[model samples]
Target chain A: MLSIQVIADVWDRHLITMRTIEHLHMFSIALILSIIIGVSVGVFIYMKPKTANPVLNFLNIVETIPDLALIVLLLPILKLGAGPTIAACVLYSILPIARNTYTGLKSVDEQYTYVAQAIGLSPREALMKVRIPMSLPLIAGGIRIALVFCMGVVTLGGLVAAGGLGTVLQNGIQLYQKDAILVAGLWTGLLAVLLDGFAGMIEKKLHERYGTW
Target chain B: MQTERLFDRIESIQFKGITKKYGEGFAVKELDLEIIGGELLILIGPSGSGKTTTLRMINRMIEQDEGSVTINGIDTKDADPVRLRRNIGYVIQNIGLFPHMTIRENIGLVPKIEKQNKKDIEERVKTLLDFVSLPPEMFMNRYPKQLSGGQQQRVGLARAMAMDPPLFLMDEPFGALDPILRKQLQKEFLKIKNEINRTIVFVTHDIEEALVLGDRIAIMDQGELVQVGPPEELIFNPANELVADIVDNQRKFKHMDTLKVKDLMSPFEDKYVLEAKMEACDAVDEMTDRDLETAFVFEGDELLGQVEIVDLMKCRDRGEKLSELAKPIKTFQPMDSVAFALSEMKNSGEYLAIVMNSKHPVGILVSDEVLLKLI
Candidate 1:
């Protein structure tokens, strides 16, 4: 059985509460920025469908690059802080959201657009009113997937001196403290799961409201 | 918000020398037609027959490659396509009511877009729901998925009518319903069409539907209109084999319910008439000359009665008048069903009946003679 005193000792020594807040703070910024950019890029590709393949291919290549290397690459310009960390988090999270948004927008039933046009909706109006609303369920799903990616990158942020749960994790590994690493890693994973659960609930709600299938 | 009046009542829709090409084949070729206002004209044919293509050209859903479409003497080319569509109501096979919208919202969409007042829109939606036989209180907030297909179609019609357009274009609007539901919708639609009384161009492949609903039916084959006329004319005198085939199919579809007395009635010939003041001997001579057993005795416009040859002969020997031997005959109106007329003829023990229009005998309905006309 796990002792309560061992958990408390690890918590006080690593300042677990403060680290969790920092992790969430970086995670929130990255997720919000990723959502805005991803959705815009998705809309842009949808408008000019010819650009879809090339833009998605380019994003696909970025997604394959190792997340740690992506952060290391940004260190030259964004130099040793949360800036490189957050940039890396946004970079990694965009593909799922952008790809999902584009696919969702493009895949709306032809019947909808045809009816929208027949009923005298302007092309732009139809996109905003019919296409986007119908796309909400899929979009929410994409954002949920992006949330997981953001959490992973933000946890990696502490390796570059960006304060988060990762800082406690790095300290435990460097100092060879077994309890610190276990507690910090487990806490980070638990926080990501809780955030994923919250996003899942939102996704389910949107699916019920706007899902076509 | 002040709503602006864009299009006036449509007096005529003329498709003059219109042609539309798709790849190597023609979807519609040099079609010419005139649709009168307040009449429901049906365009019907087989799968590739250009009926839908022709209907779409009116609102520029698919613009023609050559010639022009004009409404009320104004060329449709001069109008903005979107504005023209907004002014014309449209319905399709699938009853494409927005799935995410409430019934009231779907019905009010176009009017709201036109900048109509909110409270007025709600009231109008309620009235429109009632117009389509849906209770507004029970259905206003329901999404389309919650309703049955028939109910959704009614909401589709209500949405189209929201703009109060002068013309409506329907492309197989009720094609998605089951037979019973389709028949129900057709009856409801005819009632609604009667109430709204707007110009409509409808497209369908069902011949029975065309015959039942159209004031004038236009049949197309391989991108050209084979015939355009009232249903009776098309059945009696088809322009080509395709049209004859369609008419033949219509007979099969309706199971002869569409056949009426007007289709088989003939003009009441003067040779079969005996003047009311004529001598019985002259009446016998006239009836013998025509090789007939009976002649109608008429004094100008008044139908006195039918004079049988045997009765006329008896009167002739006594030197009596043809009017004195006249006997009453059964009469029927031209619009009655052929089956009803046949049953009447059987009940009255008469093979022939006078086809009348209220006070005047317009034609003659003969059982064997009309059956021979079908050949």
Candidate 2:
């Protein structure tokens, strides 16, 4: 019978604690970087609305490229390390964040913008004060989606010799260590659920604070 | 009273041959108009008739392709558009109070943008809420979505009046409201306007609203001003078939021509009389003695229109003499149509009309008595 003791034994031997820390590190760095790049690009596209469809289409095409293929493609340029893995994860995260941000900003009531202008707010001021604040729930939603995407992609970083819980699962499978694989799989899922729940809490708080979606 | 002093500083807005075109079509053709300070000029027309376009030009929301729009003799183009807009208040039909901001913040926005003192902004916000008849304590903390349409519109108006700008531009400000609410807001707006004395350019497609609120009405058609005059002039002497047609709809239902002064006239009474040179207290005593509602002032053989006891009371309140309260007479022949007399009475805001027969006054036509006869 597969037991908890056996799972603990596998976790201790495989340095599961270090792998979990590496997984969280990769996910968080990629998420932060993705948010900065994605949000900025989204805002830029919103300002130059004519560019939105083209930019989003390009990002959509980038998203269609398999995650493994993207990691492989980046390997030659970035080499086998955390760098390429984080880059791949960031690339994977961009589509949801940028698309949601663009859609959110674009969908704000046109009357609010008109009133902002009529009240003499400069375009920049209006965007910052009215548009951005109103679009918060959606922007936060995008960030949450990107965080979830990062969690999954960070696990896949193991394929490129990048350190994370995926390495444990891969090694256990090769060695026929069922307990090791099960333990790693269980922790990875737990981490994903935990991070997702945290993101959900943030989105909820933002919706409550702004009182809007 | 403080608003009166602020009002006197505003100069008239002049549109000198201003023209705006969108591609091959003109939204507003070469237009020349002078909107007097502190007056409510209503621009009215059918859809796509350039009433909105003309109003937008005043604040340079839609730039004029030719000529210039000058506020207080200063060309709008010369002033920074943003700065110029900051100084002018604007309201729209949508009541665009920012949904994210509380009602207080929405109303205080202009003052905040203008960098007024924080305490002063709070005080002004409270004052404006009261002015619009919204209690600050009840509404200040609430978001716009929580308010009803009428309340949101009141907040919109309060927001526009936040900085107390001498000029206000409204583009169908109350067009979205139900008819009952529209009428109530219109009456309230008239009261507010009387107190503030701001130069207002109001846009509306409803002819009835135009007549009810405009100090002067400007009718537009095909991007051109068809006629501009007081509501009475527009009703009695329309510039063309279109203006006549607009008035005719209301005139037909009113049965205006069929009414005559003789049908509504009341017999002249001796008790309702006072000499032109009578003392103020004596006039009041005479009215009190007979329990008369009005007293006609006489100078020798000539008859002047009657002054209501209400006017005497108002004179007392203002510490003015009885002679100051003797309004000039509006005399109509007994054969004159009731519509004509009614129009005169509406224009003058007097309830009593003198019905004269060639040489002397024969009777009085009280609006209430006339209305009763109609029923």
Candidate 3:
């Protein structure tokens, strides 16, 4: 087993604590932007169903691009540091959130909408009152998925001088320090798992409230 | 905000040459129907016969291709569809109570949208629950899924009645119920209809339910109106073979099941009635003259059981009074179906049943009379 002092020494040498804060900061920004844009796109496609296929296909293509390749492509436009990393994370995350929202909105039992109309709910009211509430569990599920993707991408931010846990791992590889690589890698994974676990709890809460069906 | 027009009442709805088509086939074709205000008119037909389509047109759920649906002589096309719908109470087979909302929240949605006072809405919701015979205290806070199917349906009715719309459009609202529950709800619905003065357009495929609930029924076939009349007219003077067959085929076989003991009961003949103090010979003479196997013994309008002619003859030698020889008889409520009375008679080994209404004997049903009515 690795000694506690050795692990603490490695943690201090690369400033892993500051790197984690930077990783989380980038992750939050990217995730928030992804949620806003993804949900808007989902609602747009739902309202105009004809565009759903094209838009989702385009997002799928963005998702297929390797993470580093996406960052490299964005660097010319968004520059290095946290900007390209955040942009790449958002680009990767939008598909899952948008697709889930679209599916959720579409899958609401058709009867609820008919009832809404019969009860004199305008089209907007029907969407706001019935459709949105019914779709929440699914949207929350998508956000959970997006959360995992953001955590992974934000860790990779350090490779491009974005200052996250990924930078410590890069330093360990380049300098051939086994302690730095092992400790930073484990910590990054633990952070991602913790955040994902938090998101899962939120999803469970939303499911309880809105997935009574 | 523009003030939304409020329709205080709708007295009549007239469909003039209204048509709706899906692809090549017509859902409803050139249908003309006049619904008088405040009557429960049942639109009945086999499935796909356009009864539902016609009902939806009144509220503009399914818009007609041609012609106007005029409510109280105002063309529905001229009114905003949303504003028009708020004035119509609607119910469907699925009940359509929102799953996420509690019973109170579901019922109060429309009132909130219309900006009604909160206290008034709560009061109205309470009265509406009472109208459907559901006590608010127990059910008001429950969610839709928490209630049984029957309870959910009652909440559905409470929601529709919350609008207090002058016209109600119901499409097979009780079609999902089991037979026993359906009959009970039908009776309860009739009581509710009596309590409210409003027009109703009910759609159903079940002919028996239509006959039971309709003030007048309109039959549809292949997207065409076959006939429209009161249940008596359709049963007695059918305009065509299809109409005749509708009344004959469906109504006759299930007549015993649909008919109540009250419909077949006859008032006990005066000659066959005996006083409790009358001598056995006098009771025998009254029953014998009318050929009545049993005679009711009454002491000043109170039924004191019944005396059989055989028992009367046997007790004559002892000079026993009618009350002394009288045997207790089974009593059935008037609402009990004739079929129920027959099955009950078979089980109990008795053929005579006193039809009681509120503990007061109104009439008697004999096996022979029940058989005659069935035939």
lDDT: worst 10-residue window of model 1 chain A: A1-10
- Comparison by TM-score, 2 against 3, better one: 3
- Which residue ranges in model 1 land beyond 4 Å of their true spot? B1-3, B250-375
Error at A144, model 2, angstroms = 3.3
Candidate with the larger lDDT of 1 and 2: 1
State each model's CA lDDT, in order: 0.83, 0.79, 0.82
The RMSD of every model to the true structure, in order and in angstroms, is 18.6, 14.0, 13.7
Kindly list the interface RMSD, in angstroms, of each predicted candidate in the order they appear. 1.5, 2.1, 1.1
lDDT of 1 by residue, B1-375 (tens): 434545679889999999999999999999999999989999999899899889988888788999999998889999877788888899888748888789998899878887888999999999998888776876899888777676778888888888888999999998986553465478668879998899989998877678768999999988998889988798878887788888765353244456677776677767677888988877766665564556788888888878766456555457777667777777888788887777767667665678889987888776532222342
A58-143: candidate 3 lDDT, tens digit per residue? 99999999998999888889877999999998998899999999999999998899999987889888998899899999999999
Model 3 clash pairs are none
- Candidate 2's residue-wise lDDT over A1-213, tens digit each? 558889878888999999989988888889999999999989999999899999999989989998888889999999987888899888978888898889889889887887788877778878987898888889899998888778877888888888999899889889998888888998899888987898899898878767462
**RMSD value for candidate 1:** 18.6
Candidate 2 clashing pairs? none
Question: Model 1 misses residue B363 by how many Å?
Answer: 36
For candidate 2, the per-residue lDDT at B363 reads 83
Query: Which run of 10 residues does model 1 chain B get worst, by summed lDDT?
Result: B366-375
The residue-by-residue lDDT of candidate 3 on B1-375, one tens digit each, is 323645667678899998899999999889998998889999987788899989998888888999889998899988888888888898887659988788888999988888888999999989887777666775688778776555667778888888788888998988887543465467568778888878889998777678778899999988999999888788778889887777667354446557788876776456546889999877655654454445788888788887765456555557888777778778889888777786777677665778888867777775432233344
Sum up the clashes in candidate 2. Answer: 0
Going through the candidates in order, their DockQ values are: 0.38, 0.32, 0.47
TM-score (all chains, Cα) for each model: 0.78, 0.75, 0.78
Instruction: Kindly report which residue stretches of model 3 are placed more than 4 angstroms away from their true locations once superposed.
Output: A6-14, A174-176, B1-5, B115-120, B250-375
